[model samples]
Target chain A: MDRSEIENLIARVALKDRAAFDQLYDRVSAKLFGVCLRVLNKRAAAEDAMQDTFVKIWKNADRYSANGLSPMTWLITIARNTSIDRLRARKKGHQDIDTPGFELIAPGLNPEQAVVAASEASRLSGCLDTLEEDRGKAIRGAYLDGETYADLADRFGVPLNTMRTWLRRGLIALRECMSQ
Target chain B: MTEQTDIPRDDDVLAAELVLGLASDKDVIDGRRRMSTDAAFAGQVVFWQERLTAMTDGIDPVKPPARVKKKLLAQVFPKTRVSVLQRVWLWQGVSMASLLFAGYLGVQLLEMNTRPGTQPTVLAAQLVSDTSGLQVLAVVEPVKHEIALRRISGEVIPNRVFELWAILPDQAPVSLGVLPDSETVRVLVPEALRSQAAQFTLAISDEPIGGSPTGAPTGAVLAAGSMTEL
Candidate 1:
């Protein structure tokens, strides 16, 4: 579904139309589930997080229009933020010891290639590619894997301050590249 | 708009940090609070979120298990007005049947108490699978640290062992033990994990023989329910 269709459905969802809510779920649940799975990294927890995401969407659909975001953007923001909250909660409970690593399983292209395809993601991918490969991967890993700065630092074998500097500079470069 | 120039300002950097999930949880919470009051900062964060989310375009979409939608629907539109009326009517019918069953159970418990034969069940959970319509009723005797599991639904897959797990909130699943196949099986809960019985949820997973080799549930969670005081 395109942006307008999703927006209209969300508007109806805000009105408590059960049919529209079902349609919204049908259109977006798979993508949102993938987002949750990547962030939570556990099937059961990801499912729970996805369920909570929809509930939040149902409750907070009215907040969408004021955000000046595309419908999918708004929906994904909710999904990502909810998963991040779950990540933080899990971390607080000291449950990170057994987080199983998941393998990315897309059909045609490898993950990085697919990410850079000339489609909706092309502009962002091109901008990210301008950064050092490690820095770009750090940004992607932070967003996709819900890694903390500390976690990224450990993964990259860099000091925490150096990781932060790399990311800050990388974000600036990405912003500059997107503007062009 | 002036802040959109080549160099990102401090607030823009903060917004980027928050959007990237690299900020500490406290910082993120403060950032959200700032976004509520600071329009320009909020817009910057949304801009970053939209652009970064586009990068996820490559992630493949996997169809969630069928029960997810079913459970979501049940939660979302729990009982329509018409269904509420139907539920009331059904409850009235079931209440009579339940009363009779409760009376019969009372008599059986009284007999057991008088005979000093059976320990009273201290805790119980009815593990129901929304996907498969499987129900396993479990009753625990705290003093003995033993739980009796009875299969309320007879649907069982051959060669797949049913493993029971205890899941505390925000914690990884701790293996309780493998459950029996056909009849009621009384399994002992390990002493170290017994204190968690009251607060945690009991879930059953379909695992290979000898249960989960890694000390965690490796199979689909077939059924789960929270323990309740009995």
Candidate 2:
């Protein structure tokens, strides 16, 4: 849905519009589910987080504002934070969720098909190209392997501070390169 | 040579650490606290959001169990007076509660205006943030001024006066002014802040019931807004 339409629905939801709230749920649940799965690393846990996030959104619908951020961003922020909270609660000494890296599924594809297939994959590949070797590896290791900074430090045989600096510097470089 | 600015130049670095989870427990705690009050850091969050959001794509989509949605539906459409999780997640934050309260009040005021024997000309509204997230701490929008504020630890807001500060990215916070009266304070925003709504904080401080003596925040913060912009 567009911004104005979403805002209007939010306004109605603030006024206790239940149908609008349902519509809002239909629009963003998939993306939110993806975030939950990433953090929780389990379908059941991710589902739990999604439910919690939307419930929080429903109760807090009145707090929406044009001054702060877009409605989608607001919903995503809620989902991300709620998932993080669940992850914190389930602290099994695991930080990152175990996930696989992207690969080019089909080599020769049409333009639209190619985009549909590699939208994020292409962005990651491009952004990865601009990163320094070690920083890129550090980010990949932590994010893909679900390794914490401390864990990464132990694996890399570096101090915690040094690992932090590497990850921090790596992210900055990636953000800069991608923003352009 | 030494730099003249007090802004943390390593903010991007800090943001990176945050995404990488390389940030220490202190960084996460401090970042969350600062996000409550600091507008610039809020913007930094948005920037990081756009960046790290792509990383989420690597995960394969999984269909969740039905019980989850059933429980969620139960929470959203609660049969009783708000659920437990709702109160904890929605109301715990200083800004979120205030904002929801203001919105409730705004809806009431709007409803009242729509009643018979009333002639409403302009609509007034206030936006508040959830304490759980980086958001506006408190907001009271009258006819003239839209009073919005975020939480800042150790920020001093005196009895009568309100201290206003402009937060900039990679720069020191600049003072806007002290709110002399509670009526409607229009803060003259810096040019840099015209495009930055999320990184600046408008703090109200207690003074001699008149204004600030030192031209900066002199008391604890009464209200503030998360610097996250639309």
Candidate 3:
């Protein structure tokens, strides 16, 4: 679904319209599920997180429009945060030791399809291309994999402070690039 | 860096760190404290979250198992659509009836206690909360391993389930399963716990639908009382 359609469905959902909620689920569940999987890195946990995310979306639909964020962004945020919460709630000593490489963006896309994917996607891709290669990768790794500074430091073979600096500067640069 | 430029810059970085999930648990808790008390800090966190979320566009979508959707629907739209207040009213009505029944049962028990021929096997307790003015009267039949719970007063938080627990002396609370939504609920005390019921306290806690996912009480203990043999 396009952005406005998703927004409209969410508006109806705020009114407790069950059909609209079902429609919204059909349209976004896969993408949200992907977000959950990427952050959690476990199928069963991701499934649980995905289910909880939708329930949270249903209960907190009223808190959405007031935030002034795009529907997809809002939805993704919920999924990501829910997954991260699940990750943190795991056993105290548990850590995701495996460092998976970032998933490459889709290889083949016509210009029409790219435009239809939402300008935010295109804009973000363009901006990420402008950052230093390793810095960009670190930012992507941190967000997509729920990697902590310690995890990134180990992956990049950098001191903890250096890893923190890379991420901090990379995020600032991203903000600047996206704003332009 | 001079202290002048450092503060806001540090806040911005902290916000970004929080949104990106890169902060340590301690830092995340501190950041959340700031978010609640500082609007600008919260907005910056939202800004970073919105910007960074776009990168997830490349992650290929995978359809979740069908059971997830089924379970989600079942939870959101349970068969009974009783509102909390309505349930409370219903429970009150049931409570009044149970009180009368308990009165009858009490008289019968008194008579049974006075009788010379047979012995009766029944145990009872009253769980009360002075702050909320909540009361629950529990009568147990050890042989049958069942406890009848009657809500005497107060109501549970809407949209959450109440789970009954057996808090044994010097032991952690053991779940007795979720209380029924109605005013009167009959719960089969778990076999392992039946013999120990009289030695433990009965408490109810507010939990998410389907009870505590962790198999333990995660919410507040709304009411509790020690069991007393009648």
DockQ of each: 0.16, 0.12, 0.23
Q: Give me the displacement of residue B108 in model 3, in angstroms.
A: 20
Q: Per-residue CA lDDT of candidate 1, range A1-180, in tens?
A: 587789898887776656789999999999999888888889888888888888877877755552345577667767776787788775553322111100001112233433333232448887788789998999888887777778998999997777787888888787777766
lDDT of each: 0.69, 0.53, 0.71
Q: Interface RMSD values for the candidates, listed in order?
A: 11.1, 12.5, 10.2
Interface RMSD of 1: 11.1
- Candidate 3 lDDT by residue in tens digits, A72-151: 87788888877876776664753322111101011222344334334544577788888999888888877777677788
lDDT, candidate 2, residue A72?
A: 58
TM-scores of all predicted structures: 0.56, 0.48, 0.54
Q: Which candidate tops DockQ?
A: 3
The list of candidate 1 runs beyond 4 A from truth reads A93-122, B1-9, B80-84, B87-230
Report how far residue B153 has shifted in candidate 2, in Å. 42
TM-score of 2: 0.48
The docking category that best describes candidate 3 is: incorrect
> Better model by lDDT, 1 or 2?
1
Going through the candidates in order, the fraction of native interface contacts each one reproduces equals: 0.38, 0.22, 0.47
Off by over 4 Å in 2: A1-4, A67-70, A92-125, A140-147, A155-157, B1-9, B19-21, B57-66, B80-230
